[model samples]
Each structure stands twice: as structure tokens, then as C-alpha cells.
Target: MNSLEKQVESAWKNVDQQKDTLISEHSHHLQNSVDEELRTLLQSVRQLLDDDGQQLEKDVDKLQLIAQQFREGVEMWQQKAQSSVKAIEEKQRVLSLLVEDVSVRTEGRRESLIQRQQQRVADTEDNCFRVLQGISS
Candidate 1:
């Protein structure tokens, strides 16, 4: 039982480590991507402002496209992060419930075994007493 508990604890620890690594790696990647997109957007907007006539409309369109792409990318990353968090939270909840259930069952079984052993002891003592009385009589 102690070994089982230790195994469970070790498994949870491993899961936690993996979750942390995944979260950090994804978050860093998302942050870098967002930063890069922002930089490009800023550059595009500056170019639009600096450029002279005729192709001014094209520059404006390009800036708008860049902004739109950045918005979509950020939104996508936000959704992914939210989903990942929700999944991890659900798993954690399940693990907690499982641990609680196992602990309760183990305690119940231990108590039952202890009661049975105590009863056996009491019964043996009573039998011994009866045998001694019969011999004395």
C-alpha cells in the first residue's frame, strides 16, 4: 500500500513536470510569434505613412492585411492556451478524486481487518477460560 501510494505520487509528479514544460514551451513560442507579428505590423504601418501617391492605396491595404493577420494569429494562440489549461485542470480534478477514493477504501479495509483480528483474539481468550474452568471443576 505504501508502495502504491509512492507510485501514484511519482506518476503525478511526472505529469506535473511534463505539463509545466509543455506550457512554458508553448507560451514562449506564442510570445515570440506575437512579438514578431507586432514588429512587422509596425514596420508596415510606417512604410504606409512614408510612401507617396499612386501606390498609397496598396500600402494602406498591405498594412491592413498585416494587422488582420496579427489579430488572427493572436486569437488562435489565445484559444489554444485556453483549451490547454482547461484540459489540464480537468485531469487534475480527476486525479484528486481518484486519490480521495483510494484513500477512503484503504482506510475502510484496514479498519475491517483490525476488527476481525480483535474479535478472533477475544474469542480465543473466552475458549481458553472455559477450558480452564472445566479442568478446575
Candidate 2:
């Protein structure tokens, strides 16, 4: 009877150890599953951030291209405007020179006409004095 009791006690101790081992294994598996899920979530978030960064870079590149085109357009317009202004200035200068030449020619013609009129008046007066002298003789 004492031997039977001893065997029963030994069996009970073995069962308790096996139960502890099983509980430990289950806890470890649950922890591994939670860690795997956390890792997957972190990877997905990283991928999303990478995609957003790439799109941002593309947007910046487009804006830079547009700005460069705008600057070029402005430069072209400025060049054309300057060319037009220069052309107008040249035309004005040529017109002013022509006006000056015409004024000088007109003034010379007027002076010559005045001199001729004065000579004609003197000649007529001399002819009349001779006629009066002839009548008196």
C-alpha cells in the first residue's frame, strides 16, 4: 500500500510539469503572432510614406519646369519690346533731320526773293527821274 501511494505521488508531479510546459509554449506562440502582425503593419506604413515622397518629388519637378518656362517667356517679351523701341527711336531721328533740312532750304529761298524785289524798286525810281529831266529840257 505504501508503494502504491508513492507511485501515485510521482505521477501527479509529472503531469503538473507537462501542464506548465504546455502553458509556456502557448504563451510563446501568441507573442510570436503579435510580433509578426506588428511587423507587417510597420512595413505597410513605410511603403505608404515612400509612395507619398515619390509623388511629392514629381510635383516639385513639374513646378520647376513651369517656372523655367515662364521666365523664358518673360525674357522673350522683353527682348521684343526693346527691339520695337529702338526701331521707333530711329524713325524719329530720321524725321527730325528731314524737317531741319526742309526749314533751311525754305529760309534761303525767301531771302533771295527779298533781294530781287529791292533791286527792281531801285531801277524803277531811276527811270522816272530821267523822264522828268527830259521834260524840263
Candidate 3:
């Protein structure tokens, strides 16, 4: 039981560590990308007055579309992560119930076996007593 507890604790720590690593990596990547894009956008804005106004408006619209898609992708990732957590929790709950049931059944069987062993010992003692009495007579 102690070993099992240790294993579970280790597993939980691993999960937490992995989650933190992923979040940090994801944020770092996004931040670098955003910095690059912002620099590019700033350069474009500086030249906007020299370019055709209609073309500038179209480019802005395109950028808006790309931003919307990025947001959708991030939302989808969040939903998937949440669903995975729920599924793992449900599996853990069911497994715990199964282990508890097995433990209870094993306990009942152990008590039954102990009673049978005790009865056998009592019977052997009675036979020994009778034999000793006959010898004395």
C-alpha cells in the first residue's frame, strides 16, 4: 500500500509538471510570434499613407481574418484539454471503485478461512483429550 501511494503521488506530480511545461512553452512560442507580427504590422502602418487606401483596407481585413482563425484554434485546444482531464478523472474514479470492491471481497474470504482454521484446531484438541482419558483409565 505504501508503494502504491508513492507511485500515485509520483504520477500526479508528473502530470502537473508536464502541464506546466506545455503551458510555458506554448506561451513562449505565441509571445515570440506576436512580437514578430507586431514589428511587421508597425512597418506596414508607417507606409500606409504612401500606399493606395483601398489596398490598405483589404490587407487589414485579411489580417482580421487570420486573427479570428487563430482565436478559434486556441479555443479548440482548450476544449480538448478540458475533455481529456474529465475523461482521466472518470477513469480514475471507476478504478478506485473496482479496487475497493476487490478489497472487501478479499476481506470476507480471509475471515471465512480464519474461522475454518480455528475450527480444525478445536477438533484436533478434542480428539487428543479423549485419547489421553482412555489411556488414564
Q: Model 2, clash count?
A: 0
The regions of model 1 sitting more than 4 angstroms off are: 1-60
Q: lDDT for model 1, on a 0 to 1 scale?
A: 0.78
Q: After superposition, how far is residue 47 of candidate 3 from its true place, in Å?
A: 4.6
Clashes of each: 0, 0, 0
TM-score of each: 0.58, 0.53, 0.63
| lDDT of each residue in 1-137, candidate 3, tens digit only | 55555676677778778876886688668757865885687568657936767777777777767766876676687668868976886787578667767877998999999999999999999999999999999
lDDT tens digits by residue: candidate 2, 3-119? 534564575567557755755565567557655755675566456656788676665556556655755665576567557755765675576557666767888999989999898
Write down the TM-score for model 1: 0.58
Ranking by TM-score: 3, 1, 2
TM-score, predicted candidate 3 vs. hidden true structure: 0.63
Which lDDT values do the candidates have, in the order given?
0.78, 0.65, 0.76
Instruction: Give the poorly placed runs of model 2, Cα more than 4 Å off.
Output: 1-52, 134-137
Please list the residue runs of candidate 3 whose C-alpha ends up more than 4 Å from where it truly belongs after superposition.
1-49
**Which candidate would rank higher by lDDT, 1 or 2?**
1
- lDDT, candidate 2, equals 0.65
For residues 1-137, write the lDDT of model 1, one tens digit per residue.
56656776787788778877977787789778767876787676666666665477576677678777877887787678768876977787688769878888999999999999999999999999999999999
Point to the candidate with the largest lDDT.
1
